[model samples]
Target: MNEIKAMEKPIKFSDPLFVTLVASICCLLWGSAYPFIKLGYSAFDILAEDIPSKFVFAGYRFILAGLLLLFLFRVMSKRKFNLSGKQFSSLILLGVFQTGLQYMFFYVGVANTTGVKGSIMNATTTFFSVVLAHFLYKNDKLSKNKVVGCLLGFIGVVIVNFHSNLLEFSFSLSGEGFVIIAALIFSITAIYAKHLTGSIDVLVITGISLFVGGLALTILGLLLGGRVTHFTLESTGILIYLVLLSSAAFCLWNLLLKYNKVGKVSVYNFLIPVFGALLSALFLGETIMELKNLIALLFVSIGIYMVNRVSSRKFSNTLES
Candidate 1:
């Protein structure tokens, strides 16, 4: 007589190491975005003999990125280029909210503020995501750990801003306000994306959304007379880098979301400000006020830890169920 053997289910999510690697790559790509934007702005300023409007620059870059994404989608997937009615509508909405409006706010914010400051402000996306997710998704309950994490992250944001204030506070309130708006948009996008996870391929959705978003920006740019008068090597490089890295990271980020819990993947956003500050210091020679920056990093780290802990508990519960 032979004994019966029970078979184990295969893991639905990617392995821990792979998820970590992808997340790190996404962070690094996103972290470098500020410096690249600064470089592009500098080049634009050089050519224009004055600051090129942020909206103008961002509008062009996003359109280019969107086109590139569509091209890549066609090459890689070889799927039909047509969109269904539902997909078309969803992509249009996503494009407007995520790519078009979000970047409009972010570029304007960065134009008004220093790259380092913009990066620090961008960290608020994580906190806002928690709030948005709580309200948007019935399954996404606000647990104690998540609440603590959000509070800790908010503290870090305050510390980072406080340090900036100590250093003369010359920053524009409008700029900071734009960053906050951008964060809110991103949070909304993340929460909305959670609903789309099972319905479409991440790359497909990203490409379509970007293409549509880019087209809208292009139209707006044309209306505003934001013509590309000239392009330099630096501007070209920045555009290319932004398009490639952003597209790649967007794809990977979506993949991570599909495989992992939202809270777990979102913890990575906590690293954005911390890494962005350090990278800004290293590359752009921005001042890194040691005490405050360290405190902010600590808060962000604790927040991330809480997010992870809560996510793990939730995952375990699902497994048991």
Candidate 2:
């Protein structure tokens, strides 16, 4: 038995190189979203002021993503998805918060802000998670590094709100403010989803919540006089890409979490905004070379690095204690 076990290969998911590649891919996919979503908006001819139509577009993306993920799970795992009344109710609440309300803020925020600024602002999600975790878990209490990290992260966020002259300060609630709100919601969603995972498969939770949330957005948008009839090959292709990316990225991220420590894998998250900024510059013609943008990016990156610098020894000790 020992010999046979020794002959078996270890799971690639836990291997360092494999993890790095997958984690980087996941972040890259997520980062591409910042630019692609803006492109999506332009393709569909959705105006910046059209809130209801944005809802419609976001709803469709999540709805199809959820359905596709569910189908893939069924085929790949061959596991039947079963939900109890309580589970169903919980999923509905999650959908409302995680998908419906969160995306509402995100889409609105992205639409109103430059993708470069919006992406950098969204990095606050990690800081929010760190702060929230400190309050919830004794083992996850804040350290000096965590506090400093958070301050740096916030400084980055604040810096981005300033003009090139450093004197004129302009911040939009519909843009950066809303993105920060969405980031906070995502922090909360991460905690809530972790709790729910004890009872349900992570995939199922994500799939159902996304579907229900999308349905809510679609219905709400229609109720609020939103219509999306402008569908071209480009628009349709972009929409499909959005759906596929959402499904693939979320599921892959969860899969990584399943096999690795959150600290080790999550450190790669800083790359998301980096990718977002660069890609936004590449695709949306937005520039991140401005003094404020560069400084903000540097601060945010350093802050995130500080926050997620937990060594394996520390993580293991925390779990044991």
Candidate 3:
């Protein structure tokens, strides 16, 4: 019995690494989205409107992505599409916070700010998740290691943002505030999603969330006087790319979260800014200013190490207390 238990332990621990790899790939795909969005906005600006709006781009992409996921879900599962009253309400709330509000603020923020800045801002999702999980989910308690990790990660965020041309410490506050709020919304989504694991199939949950969120965005777009007539071939291509990649990433991410600790999975978000900056530089020819960028990379790397290291029995016991 003792020998069998010892053998089982290794498999149990190894399982999480596969999930982590999948989640990391998802983050990489999401990180690629920054440059595509930049290009799409530029193309739309030339062909459609003067303001270079993200509303039109985000609205179309999400709606299309949601519809695609719905079709896929129907084909793959013969299970009846039913939700309990409680589950239904939770799905609606998840849609509002996770998909609708989060994307809206993100799109608006990205539209106003540079891609590099936007990517760095999104890193706050992990830090905020640590804080939110401490208060919101009793199952996950904060330890000294987590506290130290978050502080280090946040310092990296500050360094990255400090290097951005868009960062103005003066009296004028504009897009930066919006982006920060967007990051907070993402954190809220992570915390809120902990309640959803056993209630619904992850694909179903993702489909419903996307569908409702897409509808909300469509309505908000109309209310804000955003016209649908601006869709062009270039914008359409960009929209397709965003939808496909985002849907794939979203599905994979939810699947991963089921098998791994949320903090462990979320550590991949730190890689986004790194990949985003590098991709922007390579494809978009965006220049990297050295000093602050190096410092940001160093801190982000350290944070990832701190967050991912598996604590031994002693550390686990200390964390539980």
Best by lDDT: 2
TM-scores of the models, in the order given: 0.81, 0.79, 0.80
List per-candidate RMSD values in Å.
Answer: 6.1, 5.1, 5.8
For model 3, which pairs clash?
Answer: none
Each candidate's number of clashing pairs is 0, 0, 0
Per-residue alpha-carbon lDDT of candidate 1 for residues 1-321, written as tens digits (9 for 90 to 100): 011001111243445545557787888788787677667767666333222355566656666666776776666667665667887788779988888888777766866776556666777787677776677667666788887887797677667556444465655756877987898898788667656756765666777667666666667766765665558887787778888877887767777776666666776787666666667777788786668779988997788677677556655676679
Residue lDDT tens for model 2, 231-321:
9999999999989888878766665655554444555666676666667777888776778668867886687567556644454465479
The ten-residue window of minimal lDDT in model 1 covers 1-10
List where candidate 3 sits over 4 angstroms from the true fold: 1-14, 46-53, 110-120, 155-168, 171-174, 228-233, 287-298, 311-321
Segments of candidate 1 deviating more than 4 angstroms: 1-17, 46-52, 109-121, 160-175, 287-295, 313-321
Better structure of 1 and 2 per lDDT? 2
Q: Sorted on TM-score, highest at the top, how do the candidates line up?
A: 1, 3, 2
Better of 1 and 2 by TM-score: 1
Candidate 2 Cα lDDT to native: 0.74
